[model samples]
Structure formats: C-alpha cells, structure tokens
Target: MSIDQVIEQVQAVYGSWGRETTVAQMRADWDRLFGETVSPDSSQPVDADGVCAAWIDAPEIDRDRVLLYFHGGGFQVGSVRSHFDLMHRLSAAARCRVLAVDYRLAPEHIFPAALDDALSAYAWLLEQGVPATNIALAGDSAGGGLALSLLLQLREAGMALPASAAVMSAWTDMTASGESYQTRADSDPIHQRRMVLAMAGNYLGQQDASDPRVSPLFAELQGLPPLLLQVGDRETVLDDSRMFAHKAQAAGVAVQLQVYDAMIHVFQQFPQHLTQAQEAIAAVGQHLEAHWPPHSNPYNS
Candidate 1:
C-alpha cells in the first residue's frame, strides 16, 4: 500500500476525535486497528512492579538484553496491544526482548502517573537482574516523550542510565510551539496545531506546559544517553523532533536525526504498508544494537 492510502485510512479513524467521539470509542478503534493487524501469540503478560506490561520476545532473542518500549497515543489512547506488531519488529531487528509497558493514561491518571509507571517498569527490569547497560529505551509520539522524561527523571535522581534511547515522531514539547505545526499544516493530514494542543490539554490538564517533566524539549538535556530521533517531514509536529535534536546535540548529547520526506507521524508503525517505515524501523534496531554494552553486544557474539 502507498503512504497516501495509509494516510487516508488513518485519517478515517483518527478524524473522529472531536466529532462526537467518546474516549472509549476512540480507544476501541485505536486498539482494533493495530491489534487486528498483528497477533500477540508470542507476547507474555507480566506485572512490572505493579505496572501492566508484557515481554515481547523475538525468535531466538538474547534474553540478556531488552528494549523497553512505550506506545504513542498522545498519552490518552494507545496500548501494548495496539503496538504489539511494532514491538515484535523491534525485538526481531535488535535480537532482544522488548518490555512494552502499558502505562497509566491521562484525564484519570494525570501528569506524573505515566512517568511513574515507566520508571517502575525500568526499575523492575533492573531488579530482575537485567543490567542497565543491556537495556535500550524506545517509544513513539507521546510515549517517545515519556521515554525521554523517564531518562531525565533517572538522571536527575542519580540513577544508572540505559545504554541509549530512540524516539519516533516524539511530541517532546507540550507547548506545541514548533514551527512545523504551521509549516506542515497542509501537508500533514493526520494532525494539526489545534489537535496537538487538545491532546496536550487532555494529558497535562492544568499542569505547566513547559515543565521539563512533560516537555523534554524544554528540559536540561545534558548527560543523557545517545539518541536516535526519527520524524517525517510532513508531520505537523516535525519541528518537535528537529528542535529537540538541536537542543540535545548542543547540550553535548549524541543525536542522530532522520527526517523522511513525505512521511507522517509514527510512520514506523506501518512497516507492512510503507517502505520508509521499514527503513526507519530497521535503522532503529541497528541503533539500539550498536549501542549496547561492548561485552553484551549481540552482534559481537
């Protein structure tokens, strides 16, 4: 299928967000869309320090290494079931197990709840005897921002950091102040400035939009792990990834920013439908594998 066709189908489902659509209905549609595409036969459910999660194991996966994944839905909708296929691809590509977390969502859990759940999952991994150096963090959209937020929280708390992290179409700025929100308004059919701000409002409520905990784009980014940021040029929040890359690089963090022309938000989620998605997801796997601890690197073995 072409990217245009994929976009059209996505817009069909996502376009109902504000048009008399309840959150429950939207959640069901979201899950049905992605869940129906991939079966969770290989997934093993687990309680990660009280947080709902699953171990997505690749065929012949190296159990020693893990890819901790968070799904994207503006922190309101997506789930482990929705992203099972994506996590499976990531697991196979990196030859590692994927710990996909079902973190608390917003308007009910509120700010800090998602972050707390993510932190709990990571800590649970450490407690399970997985070395910090053997883990990599990844997420898409809001979950991407949440991954970064978890990293920042870990760093600030003087905790051991993961080997590296990556984000695809990361909504790093809740302020929605990026220029691409306007520049790509016409090109991107999936999201707009109003929609972006509305999602932020749902997750953030009355919390400060610029808070580093919510907007990693506004945070002090020094001392974080190497980052791979993948974003589509046509996305409304394109600048969110671009600006975050610029800031993270200037703060002395290693950053690789790949901007795919004519792609949309979280395009990697559609590997079965788009060529760019295939390439981007493969690159993500390579990035994580390449950054693992030298002795534990799967490729080296």
Candidate 2:
C-alpha cells in the first residue's frame, strides 16, 4: 500500500480515538498491537546483573553476532515481550541472535535506570565472551535514546565499542524541542508535544532534561560506531533524526539516515501489513551484514 494508506491504517490501529490513557491500559494496548514471538526459534530469559532480559533467536542466525535491543515506551512501559517480534525479525533479517533487554521503566525507575540496564546488558554480553565487535545496540523511541547514551558512556569509560547501532524514530530530545513537534503537530498521527513532554518528565524525574545522558541530541556524538538511523517523515519527532544525522556526521560518525516520506513513527514495526516496513527492515539487515558480515561471525564456533 502507499504511504498515505499505511498512515491511515496505522492511525486506525494506534490512534488516540477512545484509547485508554492510563499506564496499565497503554501497556495492554502495546502488547496487543505487538505480541510476543511465541514460535521464535528460541526465547530464553536471562538475568543481566540486576536487570531482566531475554534472548530472541531465529533459525540460521549467526551464533556469535548479536543485536542487543531495548524496547521503547516513553521509558514508562514496554518489555521484552512487547518487542519480541521486532527483535526476532531483526535477528532473522540480520542473521544474528537478538538479546532483547527488559530494562527498568520510569516513575519508579527513572533516568539512568534504563540506561544502567542497557549498559549492564552490554557488559553482560562482554563478560559472556561476546566480543564487542560482534554486537550491535538497537532500539526505537526512548530505547533509541538510551542506545545513544550507552555508547557515550561506554566510550567515555574506555570500553570497547560495538560494531554498530540502529535506531527507529528515536526520541532523542527529552526537552521536546524539535520543530517537527510543532510543524507536524496535525500531520503526525502518533505523538504530540504535550504528551511527549509529560513522558519526558516521567522519565527524567528530578534529572536534567538537557543532559546528554537524558537527551542524546545534546550529547557528544564523536567516535560512535557506524549507525543506521531511521525515522518517518510524518513523525512529530522527525527533526530528532534529521538533526541527529547532521550532528553525528559532523562528529565523524558514519551514519546511514533513512527518512521514509509520508510515514509515521516506528512504521518499520508494522511489516505484517506495510511493505515499506519490510523493505526498511531489510535495509537494517543489509547494514548489519555489511558491518559484521555473515559466516565470519564471532558466534561461528
């Protein structure tokens, strides 16, 4: 279907019409829209230090190479199950096992809690003999922001970097300062400025919103590994991706920024009905393959 049609379908399925606003209900809806990968090749739960996580495996996936994923839910709701299908598909497409992290969410677990879980997950991978070169960090929305923050923390700590990273419609600005929030206010069907601001507040708690750790848009982007940044044109956070790309490039980080025209946020997650979504996912696989290469994977043991 065309992008407009895809947007309309997305609106029908996910729009705010009669949608419950409570956290409990929001979570229930998220689960229904994107259910678990019940029949994935394998799904194993794990303990990452104090964090909870799981492995989403697919057939023919490279054993050594792994895609470490963080789920997005405004840092409030979302779990490994909530994003299992996306992780499983990413593994299948990238030909690598996916470690879907169940990072702590906000209100109870605010800023740095989720980031801590992400770092802990990455550290767990390293401690498990998973070479940093064989791993990649990925997430959508808030998770994407966490991925970028984790990279900065890792680099600052002198830790070895992952092979690459991928993010989808990443909400990089905690301040909701992007122009798209205003310009795309009516066109974007998924997000709004006030809502995003509240979500950011929920995640930040007493933390500084402008801190690079909280908002990667304000982060020092130098020395990051290759990245695949995808955002939809119809998204209210469109400027997040656009500004991030320009800054990342200026920081000498190689980035492949894919802006799908007329599409809404996280459109890649709707591959079941959107062909563009599938194609976008395929591009992720190609990007990962180029960086890690097949067969030569560290998991080839």
Candidate 3:
C-alpha cells in the first residue's frame, strides 16, 4: 500500500487528537474502539503479582510453548486489554498459549518500574514451570524495546533466556538521534516527533536516556536470543530497528529484519480493516513458530 493510502485509512479511523486528553482517556477510547472486535473468551483473570494482567489461550493441539506479550502505548498508555486482538490472533496462529503482561506505565511509575514489572512477570512465568526454551517474548513499540531490554537483563543476571523474540515497530532509542527522526518525521501517520519527545520526557524523568534498559539498541547485544524485528518503512523511529538489527547481526546474534513498505507504526492495530496489518501479524506468528517450535514443549517432560 502507498503511504498516502495508509495514512488516509488511519486518519479515517482516528481523527485529530485532543491535546488535553490524558492517558486514561486514550485507554477508554481504545477500549470502545476495539471492544467488539476482540474476543473476550481468551481473557484470564489477573495474576496476584499486582503488576501484570495476564490471559492464557489454549490451542487445539496443545503446543506447550508460551508467548509472553507486552503491549505498547509509548510507556504511558496501553494495557493487556488494548492488545487483546493481536494476542488472540497470535495465539491461534502459533497454536500456543499467550500470557499478556500489563506492566506499569510511565509518568506515574517512571523508568525501571515498568522494567521491574516486566522482569517480575517473566520470573513468575518461570516459577510456573514454563521452560525458557518454550517461551518467546513479543511486543510492539515501547513494549518491543522492553522485550529486548528484558532479554539483555536476563543474560546479565545469568538467567535462562526465551528461545527467541519478535518485536514490531520498536522505539529502542530514547535519544531519538536516528536519521529517520528527521527524514520521516512528517510522513509518519500515528506518531509525531514532538509527541515522541514528550513521551520520552515522561518516561525518563530525571534519568539518563543513555541507560541501556531505557534504550536497548545501545546496550550490549551479545548472548541474546535470536530476534525478529518488524518495522514500518515510514516510521520516524525506523532507524531504531535498523540500528538494532545491524548491531545485533554484527554481534553474531541471529536476526531477521522485515521492513514493510509504506506502513506506519504498529500497523497491526488495523488488522480488521487493513490487509497489510493482518499480513504483518501473520509474519510475526510465523517467525515465532519457526524459532520456538511446538515440539520443544517442555511441559511434556
């Protein structure tokens, strides 16, 4: 699809934003928009950690591999509910269950708190007997950055890592120095440079943007699991994925980078209305199935 066509479709669905809106209002709007499109049957009750809201969907063939998902909203919005449809489709396609984490957001919790919640959820999964080999971490936007950051943290802590990870439109660089920031700043549909800067300010209050967890693309990349990155060609943060993939490959990590032409940030949000979005999510499911095969189910042991 051409960039203009994509933008028109997105703008049709989501009109001009209200500058005075809060994250809570955005969350409510998202709920109203996607409530009927998503199947509620897949939802599970929240876990006791008080840091995450999780859901488990059992596949027909019993693939023991689990996908631990983190939703994206620039670290200030989004929840497990916001990503229910994507998670459901992924779970069905991979023939495995998915555990969506509702990590704490920023501007309220700030840096490290979201990271801490993500790590805690992963630890909880491990404690539940989900083998590292049978697990795959996935997310989009800020959540995508978090997934990679979590993998880095796990490696540093000498913990078992997930078999692989799939990240889409990841905002891996808080410094936002990428060439795309200037080149694609005006072309992207959903995100604006000013908005990104504001979100970054909220996420990194009084903290260094250079911190590895806050910016995974700048972190040490060795010893991390195989990774699959799906990025839109028009996103301002396109260079974030580009640089991360380049560095990871140079560091000897297996990486697949799929750059979709003329797409915008997190295109999967329109799976119901856009063929491209459906295709993108299918690609993600395929990548997960390839790296974390159902036969590797540790539950059978």
Candidate 4:
C-alpha cells in the first residue's frame, strides 16, 4: 500500500475516536491498528520493580546493550503489545535487546505516574547491573517526550545517564505552541491543534501545561546526552523535533535532526509499507551505534 492509503487507514481509525469513545475502546482500537501480529516467542515479559515491561530480542542481537523503549499514545493509550513489532524492528536495527515499558496511561495514572514508572524501570535496569553506558533511550511521540523527560530527571537527580537517546516525532511541547500545528494542519491527516491540546489536558490534569517535567520543550536541556531526532515534514508537531533540536544544540549538546520528506507523525511505525520508514529505523541504529562506548562492538559478540 502507498503512504496515502496508510494515512487514510490511520485517519479512519483515529476518526472513530469520537466524543463517545470510551478510553477502553480507544485503547483497543489503537492496539488493533498497530498491535503485534507475529508469534510472541521472541519477547519475554518482566516486572521492572512495579512497572510492567517486556524484553524483546532480535534473532541475532548483542546482549550487552539495550534499548529502553516507551510507546506513544499521547500518554493516554498504547501498550507494549501495541508497540511490540516496532520495538522488535528496533532491536534488529540497533542489534541489541529492547526493554519495552508498558507505562501507565493518563486520566487514570496521570502526569508524574508515567514519568515515575519510567524512572522505576531505568532504576531497575541499573539495579540489575546494566551499566548506564550500555543503555540507550528511545520512544515515539508522547513516549519520545517521556524518554527525554526521564533523561532530564536523571540529570537533575545526579544519576548516571544513558549513552544516548533517539526520539521520533516527539511531542515535546504540551502547550501546543509549535508553529507546525497550523502550517502543517492541512497535510497532517490524524492530528490537529485541538486534539493535541485535549490529549495534553487529559494527561496533565490540573498540572501546569508548561511544566518542564511534562513538557520537555520548556525545560533547561543542558548536560543531556547525544540525541537523534526524527520527524516527518508533514507532521503537525514537526516543530516539536525542530525546536527541541535547536534547544539541545544551543545547550552545547550533540543533536542530529532528520526531517523525512512527505512523511507524517511517527512514520517509522509503518515500516512494512514505507521505505523511508525503514531508512529512518536504520538511521536510529547507526545513531545508537555511533554513540556507544568505542570498545563495545556488538557485532563481535
């Protein structure tokens, strides 16, 4: 199928999320649309402290390194199941294991709950003796923002940092302040300004929308690790990646930003039908490998 067809299907799924749609129904729809379809043998479930998660291994992988992943659902929907295929692809591309965290969602768990669970999983990884230098952080959309938020949290607490981080179409600004929201509105099939604000409000509850812990775009980004940010030029949140990359660079951090022409939000999620998606995932792998400790070559294992 072509990218247009994929966009139509996505719009169909998202359009069904009407005012009457229950959170449960939305969750199910999201899973049905993007959930795993292959055999479950490659993935093993685990409890990272109290946070539910799973470990996914590529057919051939470097056990020494890991990609700690978060799934995107505007912080209200999505699960490890929904994102298993993507995580598995990432494992293969990055040539490492992936610990996919099924973090709690909003209107039920709310703001800091998801962030807290992320911290818990990372801390659990550390407790298990996985050196921070052997780990990398990754996620898409809201989860992408969460990964960055976790990085900031770790830095502020003086905890060890991961080797690097990569985010795709990250929703870094919860305030819906990005100019792309308007400029790219006609081209983006699934998202708009109001929907963006609605998702943020549901996740934020009564919390301030501009809070850096939730909206990493507003945060002080000094001391963060090397970053690989990918966004579709057609995404309504395109500026989320652009603005965050600018800020990170200004903070004296190494940042690589790739804007895929004619792509949409989290386009990598549709790799099965999109060539650019495949190339983007491979780029993520290259970014991770380039930033890893020099002596740690996964292929030699």
Instruction: State which candidate has the highest lDDT.
Output: 4
Cα lDDT, model 2, residue 268: 79
Model 1 spans > 4 angstroms off = 17-19, 294-301
C-alpha lDDT of candidate 2 relative to the true structure: 0.85
How does model 2 score by TM-score?
A: 0.92
- The candidate, 2 or 3, that scores higher on lDDT is 2
TM-score of 4: 0.97
Whose TM-score is higher: candidate 2's or candidate 4's? 4
For model 1, what is the error of residue 84's alpha carbon versus the real structure, in angstroms, after optimal superposition? 0.6
Error of 4 at 83 (Å): 1.0
Tens-digit lDDT string for candidate 1 (68-143) = 9999998989998899999999988888899999999987888989999999999999999999999999999999
How close is every model to the real structure, measured as TM-score? 0.96, 0.92, 0.91, 0.97
After superposition on all C-alphas, the RMSD of every candidate to the true structure, in Å, is: 1.8, 2.4, 2.6, 1.4
Our tally of clashes for model 2 stands at: 1
Regions more than 4 Å wrong, model 2: 1-21, 36-42, 297-301
lDDT of 3 by residue, 164-280 (tens): 999999989988889998899777876777778788899998888878989998898998888999998889999999999999999999999999887888887767767788888
Off by over 4 Å in 3: 1-16, 39-41, 58-63, 293-301
* Candidates ranked, most accurate by lDDT first: 4, 1, 2, 3
